[model samples]
Target: MSPPKTYLITGTTSGMGLALVKHLLSQSQNVIATGRDIVSRFPREIVAAHEENLRLLELDITADVDTLQEIAREAWGLFPGGVDVLFNNAGMSAVKACEEASEEYIQQIYTVNLFGPMRLTTAFLPLLRQKTTTTTASSTVIAFTSSSAAWTPLPFMAHYASSKAALSAYLESLAKEVNPPPFRISVVGFECGGCVTNLGQPRQHKQQQQPQSGGSGGLLAKQQEEKTVYGDGLGKLVGMFTRDAMAYMPGDADKMARAMVGVIERVGKQGGGKVPVRLVLGSDAWESVKQKVEETQQVLEEWKEVSWGTDREGVRGGAEGDYLRAVSIL
Candidate 1:
C-alpha cells in the first residue's frame, strides 16, 4: 500500500478544527494540528495516544504578523519533508452589531479569519510546491473555512461576515495567480452551515453572557428566543448550529474528518485537480447560496437594459453620453 498523505490543520483545539483533527487521525493518516490552547484544551493522554499520526503545535494565528511568520517557519521546520495539504480552518466570529462592535473586536476577527490564513498559506506554498516537484503525480491544496455569512448578510455578525468575504475574494484572486504547470492551488471555501461548534458563543463581546445547557424546557425556550429575535424559519439552521457548537453533529468529528479526507482523495485522483472554489458543507449553506445567487441574478436582470447601452460610445465616450459617463465616473 502507498504511504498515507499528510495534512496540516490549524485551530485544532476546538470546534471544526478539533473535529477535523480527530477525523484525520482515526483514518491513520498523518496530521500536524495547531491551535492556540492545545495543551490546556486537550488531555495529555488523549494527545499522546495518537503519537504515531499526530503532532500538536501551539500557534495563535491571530498573533502579530511577525510572530505568525515565525510560527509558520517553525512549523515548516517541524515537517521538513513538507505537507500535502494546508487546511486553514482556524477562525473567529463576532456577534455584536457593526456599530456596537469595538475596533479591537473587528481587527481581531479579521486577523484570525483573513490575514492569518493568508500569511500561513504564503509561508507553506514553497513546501507544497516542493512536494509537487518531487512527486510528479501528487498535488497540493489550500482550504479555508469560510461561512454561509459570506454569501448572506447576517445581522449582528457583519464584522465576521465582512472578514470572511475579504478572505473569499483574496482566495479567488490567489487561485488565479497560482495557476501553473503540475503545481496547482485549490482553495475550498468550506461554507459551513450551523454545525454543533463553539461558534455561537459570544466570546468577543464584553456584555454577552455565556450559554448554559439546562433542562430540555430551558433549551427550548432559548431556541424560541433565538428564532423570534434572530429570524424565523431558523429551526433547521439552529439545530445544525447547535449540534456543531455542542459537538453532537452526527458522527461528530468523525464525519467531518471523513468528509475532508474524501475531498482530498477526490482532488488527488483528478490528476491534481482543484477542489471546487466553493464547498457548501450543509443544507443551510446550500439554501443560503442558492437564495443569494438568485437574488443577485434578479437584481442584475432588472437593471440589464439600464446597465447595457446600445453602443460603447453612446454609453460613455461621446458628448451625448458625457453626462452618463460623468455619473458613472463618480
Candidate 2:
C-alpha cells in the first residue's frame, strides 16, 4: 500500500492557506494545519469532520526557537514518520516607503515571511530528511509562497518585495544544496500573483495597533508625501498597479490553491518527477516578471564593458581567454 500522503502548511487561517487546506482535505489527503489563534477564529467543525486525516495546531510563527521546537514536536506527533510537503504559505506586507518603515515593522515582515519558514523547516529536518527516494512520491518539497513583487520593485512596499527576492535566492541555493542524489529534498518557490484576498487591506485597518498576525503595516500608507521628489509619480504608479490592475487579476485564491496541489501531484509521477524551483503563477505575474527580466538584461548589456572590466586581467580579457566561460565585453 502507498504511504498516506501528508502535507504541513502554515498560515492556514485565511486566503490561499485556508483554500489549500479545504482542497487537500477534500482529496482525502492528511493535512497538518497551523496558524495563530486557531481556536478563536477557525471553524473546528471541519477538522472534526475529517478527523482521521486532518490535524490542527496553533502556532505563533514569530515566536522564539523554543516555541518553534515545541510546535515541531507537536507536528511530529501528528505525523511521526515524516511529512511529504512543507508549504511555507505565511507572509506579511507593509505599505510604506523603505525609509518610512519602522524597525519594528521591518522586523515583523521578515520574521513571518522569511525567518519563520526557515525556523520551521530547520526544525522539521529530521522528518523531512527521512523521505525515501525509491517511493513514487515526488521529491520531498519545501515550498514557499513568494510574491511577484519580488521581481518588480515598487516604491511603497520595498520591504515585502526585497524579502521575497531574498527568499527566492535562498531557496534557489537550498535547491542546489539538497539535490543530486543522497538528499532528495526539493525546494520550490511559488510566485503567486494578485488574488481576491484581504492580504494588503488588514495592514491598513490595524495601523495604530501593535504588529501582530500578518501585520501588513498599512498604517504607514499615510506617509506617502505628495511634495516629495517622486511622491506623486510613485503614488499614481502604485495606485494603478494595486487597484486597477488587481481589479481584473485572473487568478482566484481557491483555484490557485487547487492548481498548486495539482503541481505537487506531478512531482513524483510515472515520468521522472520534475519540480521547477520557481513556479510563477497568473498572467499578471508572468507579464510583470518577464518585463522586469527584460529590463534588467537590457540595463546589464548597456553597461557590459564597464561592468566586466573590473575583473583582473586573468579573469576578464586574460591570457587564458576570459577565465573559462567568463563573460566579456564584445
For this target, which candidate reaches the highest TM-score against the unseen true structure?
Answer: 2
The residue-by-residue lDDT of candidate 1 on 57-156, one tens digit each, is: 8876766667766676676666545577888887766345445556777777778788888988877777667667667646467877776677876655
Error of 2 at 102 (Å): 0.7
Clash tally, candidates in order? 8, 0
Report how far residue 279 has shifted in candidate 2, in Å.
Answer: 0.9
Q: Which ten-residue region of model 2 has the weakest summed lDDT?
A: 208-217
Model 1 segments more than 4 A misplaced? 134-137, 202-254, 270-274, 309-330
Q: Which regions of candidate 2 deviate over 4 angstroms? A: 1-3, 133-138, 201-234, 241-248, 316-330
Q: Can you write out model 2's per-residue Cα lDDT over 222-312, one digit (the tens) per residue?
A: 4344345657666775666556554445667878888788887777567846668788887878899999989999999999889888887
